[model samples]
Target: MILELNDVLTENESHTLSFMASSGELMCITGGTAASRTRWLLAIQGFSHISHGYVCIDGEPLTERTAQSFRELMAYAPERLTTLGEVTKYEPPTVQDVFSLKANRDIPISNGILGEEMRRTGADVSDGRVQLLAVAVLLDKKILLVDNPPKETSGYLKNLAKQGKVVVVTSDEDEIISAADQVVEI
Candidate 1:
C-alpha cells in the first residue's frame, strides 16, 4: 500500500505539503499549530480538499469517481475522544459492540485482538475511544490516520506500522514525532 500527497494545499490555504509513505512505515506530520497538524491529516485522508494538487493511493489519483473507494481503504481517528461521541451516555459498550455495527460487521473480530488493543490503549473495554481504536484496527485498512494520539498509544501505532499498516499520525509533540519512522514537518 502507498499514500502520496503532492503539492497539496490545505483547507486553510496557508500551507502546501507533500510526502509519501508505504506499508510498514510510521509517518508523523508535525508543525505549526495543532490546527495545522489536523489539516494535514485531513488532507491526507481526503477529508479536506486539496486546492492545487492531488492525492494518490497505489498510483491512482483521488477523483470523484474513486473517492469513496479510496476512503474505504483508509480509517481515521480524530484527536478528541469527545469527537467520537458520548462515552457515558449509556451502558458502556464492549469491543464486540463496535464490531457488531453495520459498518464493521463484515470484519472478523477476535478476543485476542481486542485484548491486545485494550492493553495497547491502556483503556478499559468500556472506553469509547478504545472501542473506536479496536474498530480501526479490525478494519485493516491500508492506511490509518490518527490525530493527536495519546502519548501512551504511540507504541501501539508503531506496532501497527511494523505489521505493515501505513500509519499516519499528526501531532505537535516532540516525543510522538521522534517515535515515527518518518517525520514530515509542515
Candidate 2:
C-alpha cells in the first residue's frame, strides 16, 4: 500500500508535514523533538488525529472510525518510553517477554526464527532500541513504524523496504537518513 500525508497538521503542534512512501520504499523522518516524531508515526497509524490535511493509504483517507482497520495494516516500535519497563539502562527485553504481549500472541514466532531474525538484523539484544526494532521486524506488517533505530540495521531495513513493505523510520542518525529512499526533516 502507498502511504501519503498531505500538509498534515497536529492538534498540539502547528507544524505541518507532508510525505509519501509507496510499497518497496523506505522513508526516513528526521529532526524535531522525540515527541514530535512519535506524533507523526501515531498520526500515520491513525492514533494521533490530524487536525488538518489527510493521511491516506492507497488513496483511501484514514479517519477516526477507520483507525483500527488502518492500524491492522501497520506496526510500530518505539525506541524508549518515559518509563522503561523493568529496565535499568541496558536492561533490554528478552525475546520471549516481547512476544508474550497480548498483541504479539497471535504471531507465530519460533525459537530458531527468533534468534535468526535478531542475528540477521544485527540487533544488539541488550539494547532496548535494538530489541524494539527486532520486534517491529518480526511483526511483518504492511507498514512499519520505527523510532530511533540503530545505524547498523540500515541494510536490513532497506531489504525490508525492498520486500514491498512501507518502512517508515524516525531517526536523526546520519547513516539511517543517508540510506533512505526519501528523507523528510520534521
Candidate 3:
C-alpha cells in the first residue's frame, strides 16, 4: 500500500507538504507546535480534509465516499475519542479496558502480548506504551499513525515497518526522528 500527499495544504498552518510513503516504511512528521502535525495526521488518516493538494491511497484519491474504507485500513494511537465515539463504551479505557469493548470482545488480548512486544522493542511497560501497541495489535490496521510515543518504543514502531506496515508518527523525540525513512515538516 502507498500513501501520497501531493502538495497538501494544512487547515491552520501556512504551509504545504508533499510526501509519499509505502509499505515497510517508517515516516515521521515533525515541526514545532505551529506545524499542526495532529491535523496533518488526521488528514492523512482520512478523518479530516486538506484544503489544498490531495491525499491518495495507492493512487486512489481520498474522498468522502472513500474515507470510511480508507480509515478501516489504518489505526491511530492516543485514540481520538471524539472522532471514534468508542469512548461511549467507557471513560478513558486502558489497554485492558479496550478489550472489553463490544467490537473487541472476540479478539484475544493478554498482558503477555503487550509485555512481549514491549520487551522486543525494549520500551518500558508503561500504560502509555501499552496503549500505543494495543492499537497495532487489536485493530491490525495496515497503516499506523500515532502521536509522540516515547523514544524507547522506537524499536516496536520499526518492527511494524519491517512487517510491511506504513507507519507515520508525529514525534519530537530525537531518536524517533532519526529513525524515520521520511520526515515532513509543516
Candidate 4:
C-alpha cells in the first residue's frame, strides 16, 4: 500500500505539505490544533479538497470519481466517542451490529475477530476504539487514520504497521510521538 500527498494545500492557511508513506509504517502527524489535525486527516482521506496538487493511493490520483473507493480502503477514528447511529443506538450493541450498518454491510464480521481486536486494542467491549479497530481490520483497509488515540492502542497500531498497514494518527502525546516510525509536524 502506498499513500502519497503531493503539494497538498490546507484549507485554512493554504499551507503546503507533501509526503509518501508505504505499508509497514506508523506516521504521527502532530504540532497543530485539533481542527488543523482533523483537516489534514480529511485531506489525506480524500474528504477535503486541496487547492493545488493531489493525493494518491497506490499511484492512482484521487479525484471525485475515485474518492469513495479510496475512502472505503481507509478508516478514520476520531477522538470523541460519537454514536455510530444505529450501530450504537441500541444498548450495548454487539460487534455484529456495527458490521451490520449499511456502510459496512459488505464486510464480514465475526465473534472471533471482535475478540481479537478488543484484546489487541486493550479496549473494552463498549469502547469505541474496539468498534473502530474491528471495522478497520475486517475491511482490511490499507490505511488507519486515528485522532487522539489512547496510549494503550499504540502497541496495537504498531502491530498493524508490522502487518503491512499504513497507520497515521494525530496526537500531542509524548509517548505516542516517541513510538512513531516518523513524525510530521504541521
Which candidate has the top score in TM-score? Answer: 2
* Collision count for each candidate, in order: 0, 0, 0, 0
**Candidate 4 local lDDT, 56-167, one digit each (tens):** 9889998888987887788766664444464432122345544565667766667787677677786565776666666566677779888777777778788888999999
Question: Per-residue lDDT for 160 in model 3?
Answer: 87
Stretch of 10 with least lDDT, candidate 2: 89-98
lDDT of the candidates, in the order given: 0.75, 0.81, 0.73, 0.75
Better of 1 and 2 by TM-score: 2
Leading candidate by lDDT: 2
- Which TM-score value belongs to model 1? 0.79
TM-score of each predicted structure versus truth: 0.79, 0.86, 0.80, 0.80
Query: Where does model 3 exceed 4 Å of error?
Result: 79-106, 127-129
| Cα-lDDT of candidate 2 | 0.81
TM-score of the candidate numbered 2? 0.86
58 Cα displacement, candidate 1 (Å): 1.4
RMSD (Å) per prediction:
5.2, 4.4, 4.2, 4.8
Give the Cα error of residue 44 in candidate 2, in Å: 0.9
Clashing pairs in 3: none
